[model samples]
Target: MRKVSRDRGYHHGDLRASLITASFELLAEVGLRRFSVAAVARRLGVSSAAPYRHFPGRDHLLSAVSAAAAHDLRSAIVAAADRAGADPSSRLASVAEAYFRYVVRTGAGFHVIYAAELYAVPDEARREQTRALMATLLELASAVGVPSHRQAVALVEAIVAVAHGYTTLFAEGFFAQGALTVDATAARAVAAAEALIRAAGDR
Candidate 1:
């Protein structure tokens, strides 16, 4: 039998990225419960112990993947905020829409990141990255004139909860039976979030 090398080739420059990609595929197929470092290595056609060379265990791999997803989501939100221009209402709508789209596109991965059970002991760096992403959204809320900074954070959190909840429901096909398309549901949710923002500004 040929010797199974963990590093594959000499340089493992792309090992981390490859592992993360494999992790996402595994998540989409078997979900977070069945996810494992050995599975990821197997998916990547590497030695079963290959992943352990980089990831301490399954939790470390999950945290790394979740952190990457969070970064992508944060970037998407920032881009949407930029595209919304200087209009407060437009900015708020853009942020909500962006968040919804992200959830739709990254359902399984997002679930892993947000699901409490899967990430009960998230890496410290991943936790900080997640917080920074929330902070970015809160800053956008403040930019839209959400009164005080504290209120901005609260408003953003509320909006996130609504968007995330709606996305989860939609993914489970709840609105499909109600004659509502994803776009339509997203629009309604964004409109409702905008109304809340306006109401907060009024108070």
Candidate 2:
């Protein structure tokens, strides 16, 4: 990723996309609470007031940042599933691993996307990304022999819930800092997701 010169003006190029990119990095660096439109503008070498033209306010800008996270998460899960071999349950479980790794790699983005209430009232574009991820999850769930849409949805939610639990514990250092490495924690999440998927089949 090219680091944009902070000395450049907002009108130099595609400011809208630039702002989103900068905002995502800022979210990763600072956090949701400290994130502001002005901070992102400063990172991009734009006037604090300049970002208002593209983003109505901080919430709108954060919406774009979370949407970028969705894009990253969706791609990561799909790639992980592809590499998990022919076993449907394994492939589905790998998605959970991808999520665990994603949280570890970008904690702030995860918190902003999930813990920040973004899902409660997602913008239309964000909703589209959520649907796309749901579609991917459903596809993997179907592969696990999940028969009904209702069951598939439940299974997806359960896997994510369990992954969230594990990630929250490990990433936040609830366990002693050295007790569980990121990959070790991710492996546990994968096992939990697999167990959930297998249990779904038994039900």
Superposed by TM-score, candidate 2 places the C-alpha of residue 52 at a distance from the truth, in angstroms, of 1.0
For model 1, residues 1-203, the per-residue Cα lDDT tens digits are 01224443423577777888667666655667788888877766778887888888777888887887778788888888788788877787677777787767655434666657546664787888788887787777887776688898788877877887787777777887898876888787788788878888789
RMSD of each: 5.7, 3.1
Query: What is the lDDT, from 0 to 100, of the residue 66 in candidate 1?
Result: 82
Please estimate how well model 2 matches the true structure, expressed as its whole-model Cα lDDT.
0.78
Candidate 1 to native Cα RMSD, angstroms: 5.7
Each prediction's total of clashing residue pairs, residues at least 3 apart in sequence or on different chains, is 0, 0
Return the clash pairs for model 2, or none: none
TM-score of each: 0.78, 0.82
Q: On residues 90-113, what C-alpha lDDT tens digit does candidate 2 reach at each position?
A: 999998899888766665334676
